[model samples]
Target: MRTYVVGSGVTKVDRHYERNYLSLINEAVNKALADSGLDISDIEYLVVSSAFTDSILNQVDPSTYIAQNLGFRKTRALTVSSGEVSGAVALDYAHALIRSGKARKVLVVGFEKMSEYPSWIINRVYSKILEHEIEGIKNVSPPEYAAMIMQEYVRRYGVSREDIVKWSIKMHENAVKNPYAQLQFNISLDLLNRALRISEPITMLDSHPIGDGAAALLVTDESITKKMNGALIEVVDIESSVNLPIYLRDDITYFSSTAAAYKKISSKNEIRLDKTVAVNVYDTYDIYGLLIIEALEICGRGEALKCLDEMPYLNIGGGLKARGHPVGATPLYQVHELRELMSGSSWVKYDGEISLAHSMSGPDNNAWLILLRRWV
Candidate 1:
């Protein structure tokens, strides 16, 4: 009934403008199998996560195509897309399959090819996140949505420009160590303060770039882990939720869906922050990571800055910002970072470590959080 991540891998998040979807995934999937000490023969099911493939590569039912090409022709395959949350959702499916005893091992892959199209075209595709009334008609894009939320948060919470810059700087620093990260340039807080603003307080540096890459994870039951001697990161709890829209949420200060997920994770695991060692919350933008701290109940409202001062914060080295937010592959990257951050002589980990990952598609919609723990 319990599922554990046996192995995981991610391709270097970079501009693979020359490569197609299948090619990108081929590298990622092969790395995943090698990491898990398993082969294609051990895979019983495949879950592919991609959203831009239809327009970018003119491909549909990519899961089947990937399965066929990977020599898992007869294995069951499913494709899922939920904007930026596509990767996390695919992971959720893999966990479900393992929990239900329907599959012994599920290979979950999330890939996106955004650089294949022009910026305007990519913006048009991202516009699907909004309603037909506002965004669909006015062409409000993802960056604009993030800008609005960020403006409101700064105004309401009195979060200074320095707070946002710190997050970006940290993520970039972390990316330097993460060879798989797309952007590894480090900018000091002083340099960030001098940069031009994007929309109000939102600067160009506050956002994640359009990246192309793939990430994969091989999830299986605990019994399989024992037999394989693979690295074990137990999934103690996982939950998902959605809110009608940003306006409909109880508060815009933090995502309601994330709050809902936090409650579920706590209730299921009966654990609290005192026991948690770290968190890898979705950080598509600087403000989102700031909002996540409050939403996850790790700190009180407008207390993220204080929390950062005392406790380690999200996106240690340039989270999604520097790491590359390859839409469909962000969640898997988070898991990858979590596993490494908790193992060996890592920067942050304790005797009994518990790490949490939180992600969302748009606003508060299609949210999910996973609680993971290191065994001994």
Candidate 2:
């Protein structure tokens, strides 16, 4: 049995002050169902992914309410949350269900609403992604962790701060062409330098913005694909790995979880970066995005910044930086963007058959890599 993504829908990453969580989910889900040429009745399962539902929404067992809101009375529904990688984790679960002969069609929805909360509260929630016993108790936040990594990376690789700034600038430029991106305006070196500092060497522009958004994908087995018209994107392989917390890791600059997941996928199928149409990486912070490219072996260690010009397809959707990191919804957004790009429906046109999406939890404590191939 093979799993394929037949349809996908994504909302623009923004504050979305007017819409509630249910409304956002409905919009994405309806669009996905429409695109797949399937009615709501066709879906047998629903997988919801969210990170801050408990803290932000004050809702527990979100899957139950979400299924009820979507009118999925009898559909088997569950929620998957693994910090920022919740979307990818949910996707992996849906893919497994189809491969295991459990279901023919699965609906995966990832959503997050962060703008409703104050910055202090949001930061406190995000800090919990760290090792709660150690880092969280000390109030260590993601940006602070990123600053440590960036400092070490610059020291180890001799990469200049200017080179890192260039990465954010390029991401903003890419977002200018992406209608769904949150920060859709091009940025300059001047603005980045002048931006308020979040931590030493990490300014506000270096981090992904707080936003609200939702994305949905309709995953179905090959049997359903036979009846669908046009090409479908196949889930070639989905692999994930876990690493010790950043405090336990010997090297702050390396993402062992990312490398481990990619290695597993590589053993199962040959991944040709040259043939890849686009690569979406988890760039909650600019430095982490650079580190992920290196972990994917797209470039040598510490060479990601230097080779940024060479990897034109990297983060064409503006990445988590400019595109917005709505936590659990981000990975789904990556897949949706890649699907559009492969089908030539994206604003940033690209002609290719393969794409890869990477997502990770805090500091690469857990990571997932999804390989997608266009089945024409």
Candidate 3:
């Protein structure tokens, strides 16, 4: 019965074509209630994270049309569509409505617009979030079922092609210092040999574009963070796993909800995943960001492409492959790119307290993992 994340916000993940979806959910929900100094009447509950739609904005219960266009009278709006981890299922339903006493303040939002259609109509609405009557309605999508499980994990783990283009060139050099990244340029390896393959071994530069924005968080509990302070992050542990659908998984090549968020974040954080300093999963396809570093066992099986030149803060927010996979607002921009890369300076090349954010939905039935730390 605990949770904290005082405040968060994000918006620039491109293709917003001058804002829509209720002004990108009222500019990332009023900059996450103005970064949680708070006062949208101290938000009660709103937890949206629904996605994919845009026939001139068909508002099919978009969290009660963004809580009746933000007037929010008497709060309590919900949505949480579990695909693309509908923003980590609306931040695990606002951390279970503030640990179940039933709200002390919760506002997690996660909208998406997908450039208002036509990329063959949002890739057929991202193939209706898979399991399309037995895997992609018989035409196959989700980048041809993740390019046939990344061409059988690069032919049963012999993986190469410079270890599969080194995680799209290290997530575009971590999205070039991530200004709310939506593909913040930077890519080479000979321009990925003229990419644009689309589904051979997946490319167009390893996918994750056509993104629209909105990400937010407010979460509360430590008695509303002792009457609100600046930068705090807690969410000690949160785990979720639901699999067995891609033609009933037995072993459809890993992703039992990323091995159940790596066995529930290593049994509720005894500490592992190479003593996490940084690692945001759900790479929005660079072959599941190299099978989520061997499904979060942190490397072993197929040795996650030679442990990506020794994992120095992998993903570092350039995850969701250069931070644009705005599906269900991308798990609230993975807690707004790991709370803006672990709130302010701590230089010295490592240890930003602790961090890990994972999210998924459908195909990997529905997965979630979040474990931040840093409060001191």
lDDT of 2 by residue, 1-376 (tens): 9999999998889998899988988999999998999888888999999998998999876778988888887788889988999999899999999999999999999999998878888889878788878888888888998999999999999988767988898899899999989999988888866898999999987899999999999999999889877778998888999999888899989999999998998778976564144899999889998899888888889888777887778888999999999898999999998888887788766767789999998889899999999877
Cα lDDT of model 3 by residue, 1-376, tens digit: 6888877777888887877877877888788888778877678888887666533266665888788877888888868776788787678778877888688888888877887867887887777787667666776677776777777777887776546777888888878777778888788777666888888778877777778888888888888788655567887777877877755666666886778767877876787776245778776778787776677788777778777878777777688778778788887777766776677632214547778888776446677888888776
Decide which is better by lDDT, 1 or 3: 1
Candidate No. with top TM-score: 2
TM-score of 1: 0.92
**Deviation of model 3 at 47, angstroms:** 11
Q: How many residue pairs clash (N, CA or C atoms closer than 3 angstroms) in each of the candidate models, in the order given?
A: 5, 0, 0
Clashes of 1: 5
Candidate 1 regions with alpha-carbon error over 4 angstroms: 193-197, 274-276, 345-351
Give the range of the ten consecutive residues with the poorest summed lDDT in model 3. 343-352
Per-residue lDDT of candidate 1, residues 80-149 (tens digit):
9887788888888888888889988898899888888786687677667677596578766666667878
In the order shown, the candidates' Cα RMSDs to the true structure are: 2.2, 1.3, 17.1
Q: Estimate each model's TM-score.
A: 0.92, 0.97, 0.35
TM-score head-to-head 1 vs 2, winner: 2
Q: Rate the local accuracy (lDDT) of all candidates.
A: 0.77, 0.89, 0.76
